[model samples]
Target: MSQPVYRYYAGASRTSRSRSAAWSALRWSGSLAVALYLSWLALFPYPSLSGAAADWLGGPIHRALGFAAYIIPLVLISALWRTFKEGRAAGGVIMAAASLASLISGAGVLAVSTHPFGVSPASWGGMLGSWLGEGLATALGGFGAFIACAAVFLLTLQVVLGLRLSVAAAWIAAVAADDFQKWRRSRQELATRMAGAPKGDDAVKDAAPAPAPAPEPVNVIAEKAPSGKGKRQPSRDGGPMPAASKRPGKYALPPLDLLKAPSGAGNTGKPQESEIKSAILALEQTFEDFKIEARVTGYAPGPVITRYEVTPAPGVKVSAFTALEKDIARALKAKGIRIIAPIPGKDAVGIEIPNARPALVVLREVLEGPALPPDAPLLSFAVGLSASGEPLSADLQKMPHLLVAGATNSGKSVFIHSLILSILYRARPDEVKFLLIDPKRLELTFYEGIPHLFDPIVPAEKVTVVTNPKEAASSLSNLVKIMESRYQRFQLYGVRNIDGYNKEADKR
Candidate 1:
């Protein structure tokens, strides 16, 4: 009895698979037939066996599209391929826009190329082409219309094909820079060869064998100048040579490509209208229950938070909402809710609620995007994305001294990580240095021997990353002495600041 039941279940599974395979085959066959028929309609003038049906169907399309009708079959094949491979026929709004642009631009190209008054009335370009093309020709002349349509077509191709302009631009720049460097090297080599080569016939005469000169008398008290080391030289007091000075090599900042690109699908990642409406309704209901009269007027969507503007009715005290902040958060089911009473330069109060899935902010965007100032200092770093979704950059030089006070996992470490990456991507070790003191020790242990640390020549195990309280305090005290010393020098030099003092010293 058990074997019979097992056999029956196996037979049913096989039957289901067979049915699915048959359905898929049929769908593909139908799609192929339709594609081939459409291609024939677009390309050939001959009618099918169903002559009347073909004429009825293809005549209008041919008349409206003319030569541009070829686009229909091409688009259909591409969409069919995408559906077969990726389980989808279309993408987002940009894809739709690209398709429309292709159609219009194709028609415009055909219309402008064909003479308006010459040839048959129903020429290669149909009525739409004739209408669109002749108008553009009349407005901007034939050549201008052709250029405009061609540009639109090219731009549409880029969008539809998902080509990256940045990658192409970078490739071009790299080729040009490499070529320029090679050219400079060739010129320098030629110059050096010319400089060393014999000058006139005198060099040929000097090349002849010559007799050795008589030795000059030596001064017993004179010191011999040092030459290349066949053996290590001793110091002036006959001790072993002091350790050689360690001059740093040219330092290049890490490339921006090392950082990951943003993972957004080119959307703001804002809450849906339905969600916002529901939130507004819940908030209003909560206020009503508390005997307060207020209604949500507007909302600003952001990556991490959505701020809703609330307007209280006349005679309603603002304190009423503040007193029930916790209750309102509970009703909205939102944590870390913030309220701005009578928001500055605004008539309504603002309530900020955290988003469900907060968008991850990447450091690369802050470094490259317009969020940071164009003339920002070398020490400037990205803070984070603001509530309104704008990236914020702050200058450590301007802050001079800043305190990081927050609970564990409140993004203090995350902020520091961004700061380190920002500096690594912007400045070299010689231009700026870090005196990192991680009391936790674990947060900064990985950056132990990095050349950007203050007193980098010292052994990494000794003082690179100060973790002990006593050591950090000692370092700070030493820094104070250095700062006072600089201040005295500035006063003596009659300069107000470091920049001023440096400029004055440069003149000397």
Candidate 2:
């Protein structure tokens, strides 16, 4: 029973294979028929002798003569050529060369046939030879014309068919692209669903949670055993451990003297905001004692501090002020304090204080602020919170250009977004434009519909997508042309940059 089943399955497989082959052959036949029909329309002027003769032969005679005589031999020759060249696949090249040669030969024959010239022999031998030569030439010329006309007809047919094919192919490609996009969206949705599903313990373990805190150590001490009669173990918690007898490789905490004083001065035995204020005032007094003028910049909840922007009196060396950083830190009763003496490009010093309650400055507020003048030279950037926890804004006109570097998740994107939002709020669409190139496809896609956008959100033409170094070089060549044209315009107008040109235009 199994043998019979196996045989039946094998037979079915064979049958299916044969059917597939037959279908492929049918499709090819149809395509060939179409190609030939088109070729015939273009090359109809060229006649086939065999086809002509058969048509002229009497109806009964033609039926007896059969069309197979002309068709069968040509079909056999084509099949044989295809089979022989199947491995190398040079048939297309051969066909193209043959077509070209036929066209040239046809043109030559047409020219010769249209020319009016007759040759007369002077002697008997010459006349006989001339007659034979003339007959041969006429035959060759007729054959050439026939081939040329056929080639032209076929070529014209190919061009028409190719155009139709191209249009059809474009439509198919568009449909396929749409389908692919839909598939991609579906896949993303599926992935998101899977990610949202409850995970197992293994998945939790893979996430690797934060390490557990270490246990605290106890101090122990030992004393010399009674004259070394026998060594005795000391109690674990008796007295202060000798420095040498302490646990190996353990670090000793720093002395309490290094700790900073609480922001307030004169313990009122009751914590009050006045005490915190007094503490800051006391800190400022200390700065005065050092002969350094300091101002209180920020104060908050605990670890209260103040910022001082100071300038040493004239004739005081900046280095002399910086040298007091360690002494200032010690005097302030603070563990850590930074001093920026004679800040870069300025004669003022910057001292920062940690605040008790740092104020939060939302980015939205800055973006909603008043716009800068059209002629304003400065570009502003939001640097993070100062020591006092106040949001800081730096004028870019002073820096000109900034180079920002940070590790991942360092708020780089947020900073950039803030800058863009600020600019958008301050400048009109005509006054500013952005050239955004985000290959990842997400960053600037939101701004695609904005009128200020120059090129399409995504390049529409393949030629514009520079895929190679050579293409980039070609692009640079075009850019050079644009630059040269701009320069010429500048020269003609006797202006400098875009600003000068715009100013002159306004005057005109």
Candidate 3:
């Protein structure tokens, strides 16, 4: 009984497969019949060849295409071939394309081929072709009409062949370019290897061992590393470094490799899961101790701070959170906390605290990031990371004056270095001038005598760092004179700013 049941199921499966096959066959045969009917009509337009169907269908095609009507049947047949090959529900698509191609071919042939009105249908194209051809011929001259027709013909062929000529051309070009590059690289390698090889006579002479030179004297000096709470590991990968240009007077920007990449170890700026849960528990307990009813609904982790959103129970005043800011900081054991009574555009109160893993941003990371515009001026510099870990950059053109002040070991020197380096990466010696006065020599001292420094009251040969108080005063005095002269020039030109002065000077 089980064997009969298995046999019955197999028979049912076969029956279903046969039904699917029959349906597919019916669809394809139906499309094929349409194609054949079109072909017969276009090929044989007389009633004697295909009864009344030829006169009905072929008459219009013949009148439009003249002798070229014969080609219409072949075009339709070719278009339907794809439908049969694909065996998809796209037979209508093929027929539509075939009909379009026939019309376009008639128009194109008429555009190039000239024929008189009321002449034989086989002369050029019939009345339809002559009308379109005359219009094209009058609008564009003889050569233009021919070019248009030829282009249209090629486009129609691609459509009928189910090919995008542009895509196929691009693919072919890419393949050719890849092959050419491979060949050129191989040739270069071969030439380099040949150049490195010793010639027949020199090979023997080079085989002999030479005397070793005396060891050079060595001096090792240890330096103190930057003092920070946590030691940072060196980055694994720096940006790509290009060979520095050697052209004089045309100062190429320094290579990107000079700046350090961000470290990969532990500076994610996000607190651990246990830390967050503990903080939230402490926050609720602290409120409970203060006779306040509030709960942390959600939290947003960022590079420097994590903001916890607190939704108070009904009738719990927002001022309650403000008063407990310092107490909550002590309870959570955080360095500090900022309380926003209600977050902007939201109903919940915001309590922001420092994260455990604070991120250390590098100039290299921001310079390579998308936040900075490509065409920013030389003075445009990376401003470091935002609260949400996004890199920030600023343009100095927008703010001509800036002040950098921080406690010792709080990144003031680092900020100065980043600004100088970012400028060095973009500006040339001739483009912009700088007036740097670093009293401590910790910053701006290293930029001595490499051009881009405005001439001071000192001798041209002695364009070095100004450490002495008197020399610094002289430099500042000279800078003031330069600024006054520039303002005078701006006044003479009836301009207000340096940019306006330059434009006026250029016009003069």
Candidate 4:
């Protein structure tokens, strides 16, 4: 009967409870310390916490924190692997946490590499990049190594931000192309409206004299009024007639015969029908190979480029094709490809390929085409044809300025000559003036004896070019003075623009 001998284990119970409480408190304190330390690092990497904390923790500790931060990605990966093994939902949560950690670490690395923040490479982000360089530099070259590391870091940031580089690039290209086309259309429409409108001087010259109305009989009493008796009653209806307008006699415009007709203009001997069909078939096959559902709806052959319009199957992103532009071009045996994903307003995307046999754009062809109307502005001159094979002309009165530039043997001189010739065909010498600047005298010297010159062409001083520094400077100064005088005149007239001023003068 030993039932009365059983004793309570209270001492053991108290000791176990006390141990648990101490461990819990220690854990909480450790967490709080870590959080506060992180806050301090963020607020001031080199904290001045009354200078005591800084004295206690020296440079080695600071560097250690940086290195530890840089290795966060590795730690996160290990944690993610454990969580995934434990539970699926917990794995997803760990993935999200890891992504955030990677993003922050990657961003820090990028910042240090790009700009000299005076931070040591021992710091978190910088350390990662430095390690990457040590591994990649010998194999990939210094620049390539740096770029490879940058791309890795940037990829992490992009992933977290839910951005795909290919998608973004395609979208930007599409939008830019659409905006450009809209601008061109609006400009062409404006030119059409202006071309059809009558000029003030032209209207006056074209007006016909009105036939005289049947004369009304004057009263005999009024006609026979006594001399000096009463002042003759003035006619209420009729006023003084305007002064008879004088017309400029027949001055001949420059002949269009000066320009040569476009030769071999059409697609005469370019890629044959068989070749085109083969190319189209190849493109379709490539799409099929890539598992992209698309149909080549049609093809348009142009002077320098051939455009193929492709309609992607529903639910297929246009960016898919855009991303495969190089592959498609290679398949088609072409030099390059320009993919306009979802060519604005159309359901189809456009893939422009360079023509196998490109056609030359003849200035004469543009000048002779429908680009110029019978009553086009005096300044209107053809530059080239549009993609639709229509000539494109520009108005100098609208432009008010032009700058021609090209490398040697690039047809800059020929283009300028064509422009000047176009002007001569439309305007009289007095209507427009030219001030040729020939620092490289060879290009503009041929235009010397033309009547449109504002200043007489002077012989070159030394090298058959305006090589004298002082003379060139003086000529430029003179141009500035001329420009200032014109500005002053524009201001004096109370007109906002040259066009408005010209129209006002025409009314008078």
lDDT-wise, the better of 1 and 3 is 1
The candidate, 1 or 3, that scores higher on TM-score is 1
Report clash pairs, candidate 3: none
lDDT minimum window of 10 residues, candidate 2: 238-247
RMSD of each: 33.0, 32.5, 31.9, 29.8
Q: How many backbone clashes does candidate 2 have?
A: 8
Tell me the spans in candidate 4 whose CA falls farther than 4 Å from its real position. Answer: 1-251, 264-272, 342-344, 397-415, 456-470
Ranking by TM-score: 1, 3, 4, 2
Whose lDDT is greatest here?
1
**Residue-wise C-alpha lDDT for candidate 4, range 1-508, written one tens digit per residue:** 4444433456667889999989867865664566456445434445455245644553333343443343343434444444445533344554466455554445344434553333344535445444544455556655665566567655654444445888888999999999999999999999999898788877656654554563442221122225522212222332111111122323344434455645573543245678778878998999999999998998876676777899999999978998999999899888888998888899999988887877777765665555654456766777775544456888877775577778989878777877777677556665666666677666777766665666323422212334355676776687688778878887888777666777767877
Q: For candidate 4, what is the total of clashing residue pairs? A: 0
Model 2 has an lDDT value of 0.47
Please estimate how well model 1 matches the true structure, expressed as its whole-model Cα lDDT. Answer: 0.72
**C-alpha local distance difference test of each model:** 0.72, 0.47, 0.71, 0.61
Task: Name the runs in model 3 displaced over 4 angstroms.
Answer: 1-249, 292-298, 309-319, 340-349, 459-461, 503-508
TM-score of candidate 4 relative to the true fold? 0.45
Error of 2 at 327 (Å): 7.2
Query: Candidate 2, residue 348: CA error in Å?
Result: 5.8
Give the deviation of candidate 4 from the true structure as CA RMSD: 29.8
